[model samples]
Target: MFISPPFIFEIDLYREVLLFGDGGQSGKVGLWRVWVRFYFCSSGVSIFYVGREFWDERVQVCWEGGGTPLERGILRLASLFYALGLEARKETYRLGLKEASRLPAPVVSVGNITLGGTGKTPMVAWLAEGFRDRGLKVAIVSRGYGRKDEGRTLVVSRGRGPLVSPRQGGDEPLMLAKKLSGVMVVVAARRVEGARLAVEELGAELVLLDDGFQHWALNRDLDLVLVSGEEGLGNGRLFPAGPLREPLRALKRAHFLVVTKRENPSLRRLLASEAPQAEIFEAPMEGEKLWSPLGGELLPLGKLKGAKVGAFAGIADPCSFFALLEGYGAEVVEKVTFPDHHFYRRGDLEVLRGLIPRVDLVVTTEKDWVRLEGLDLGFSPWVLKVVIRPSPRLLDRVLERLGMEV
Candidate 1:
């Protein structure tokens, strides 16, 4: 009788052993030796598989917590190296090894210290609209995080509307272009070049730099750092271990610190201690209305109350979106999340379609709506339109610093 190995081994090894077993007693002895060798090899492979799964789980724990002592210890060691690299980069900038280029026009940067979204885009849109309302020609310069073309600057909008698709201009820049009429949007890997183009070529009087806190290559007149009220600094560790892009000390460089998406007195006190010189303000992301992207029609926020909805988002902080929907009395029978700035695929649409039978409607964020413009999703999804309502005091202070009338 032929005996199988106790543990799973390579198919080729099994076949070879089975073939050799047909040769009789001598062959059976040889087959037993091969089986023993294959068993040890299989054990090693099993150990490797378990180790990899453990590593992956630990990485997730680094973001969301709840890890064993061994897992945490391993990730902490990794975080130390990450911190060393960050410090080295900061030291270079501090010693003037890397010089920042200045733009002719005044530049205002809206950024965050955390990895995920913290209403920076809304703040930029608010500032751009404010500047436009005050009779200033403003331009928005972005790195265009996921754009196809990064070597050269791509003009998303020339003050009228978006000229390029989301693939070329990036989802954020393209969304900005679509929302803000008469605001020029430019995207480049090098923000300095993008800002230069906005000021010199586009005839922009002021430049609003989106996600510019870490972009040390360009010098700005104002640095506004946004902090998410929901996820305050995450695990409080730097990248690979936590959500923080920079150390808490980086807040010292911020001219203004805006706490977004609700109020937190504890966070306010912490901000005051971290950067006493920086002006701190709370700007909640208020739900404005439900907008139909296909028909360009707007409905009141109350329409979502008690409605059975399928909610999905491709933003950095999707849980926040889900909570927002629930806040409006949405049943939220189905919730889906994709990577930040994710362009929808056919499979993604199919998933949404699967939810259609159970849900009365589908809802998504305005940022995600831009990426879905040309796609046929079988049904139109209502976009949750959110706006950052900065206090008059904050707006007054910002305008005053910029030498503009409120």
Candidate 2:
């Protein structure tokens, strides 16, 4: 018996028939029922089960012949080492072996304990805009992840305007530069350099650090850590084994914790216990609007109902973007996910190109749209604008910390 590798066949057995044409042999595929099983194999290969309602069963089965179990075991062992390394690094900073530099301007670090999709960028933008509105010269300093050149810091935007393209400044920084007109955005690997540049050269009064939780080298006045409600500390284990970059105890370092995407009272209670000293708040990160990437025409969210849509995202959590579209009443028939911060080329869009004719609309997040410029995908792509709706109390608290009026 020839067993194929893991594959998902999302079929509507009742309404749709699988018909093979030409080189492919014709056949009528039939399934009596859908089986959902978690088969743990010594050698694990993950197989995702799909049925009439593909969303109902999101679990993956591990077959023994694929060596998934051993791989998982190895990763768990590696996570232990990863935890140890993190502890050592923290100890070095704690013992004054490594020093944290302070910038002249007040710095606010927005980061996450887990990896990506935490809405740190949106939070940074929100804070920057808030400070700017209060007449503070704000600058957003990002690590400029996925930049083509690894050498030297680039000033993405000065108070005047953007100085570099997304290719030079990185996607997130570029997006921030465009969104916030007056706010300066600087990109550097060593955040200390970026922060210093923003303060000294850009004459920024405030600096917002993007993805700064792990960057212990630069001290911040306020440490605002964001946690995703949907993918809350996945598996709750350390890296390689789970999604956590550090242990749960690391929450103690946060001055404030803002749960993004949705409100979870249970998660808030748990975080409060973990970081008693920190103030917890809820900020739902959501899609605010949709606009045409080509002409800047606004597309009403209500109109998405019953529309056949093709969705693509280069984000840490593509599933969340897909779910967002579905929640907006769009039928996402063709969905594609690229690696986080993926840069798109013409050749990279072959799959999406093939899907354009079938979909009434093609949409992506604003961040992804920035990276997709100059690529002609036959159809104009719509950009979903996402905003973090900060609670009134949360906004007041943040403003209070900044010594600004509520």
Worst 10 residues of 1 by lDDT: 43-52
Model 1, 8-108: lDDT tens digits are 23211111111111112221111221111122112112211010111334566757877777777776786686677556655666799866789889999
- What is the alpha-carbon lDDT of model 2 when measured against the actual structure? 0.73
Q: List clashing residue pairs in candidate 2.
A: 41-64, 43-64, 43-67, 44-67, 44-68
Give per-candidate clash totals: 0, 5
> Candidate 2: where are CA atoms >4 Å away?
1-69, 402-406
TM-score of 2: 0.82
**Whole-model lDDT values for every prediction:** 0.77, 0.73
RMSD (Cα, Å) for all candidates, in order, is: 14.6, 12.9
Q: Please give, for residues 1-406, the per-residue lDDT of candidate 2 as tens digits.
A: 1223433222222222111111012212222433222211111222222212332122111111223677667767877877676676667678998677888778888989986588888888888888888788999988786677634688988866678878888888888988898999998867788889999988998889888777777888888899998877677777656667778987898989999998888888889999999999888977778899788799788878999998988877888889988999999987776656777654345445545667888889988988988777666889888888886676567668867663
Count of clashing pairs, candidate 2: 5
Most TM-score-accurate candidate: 1
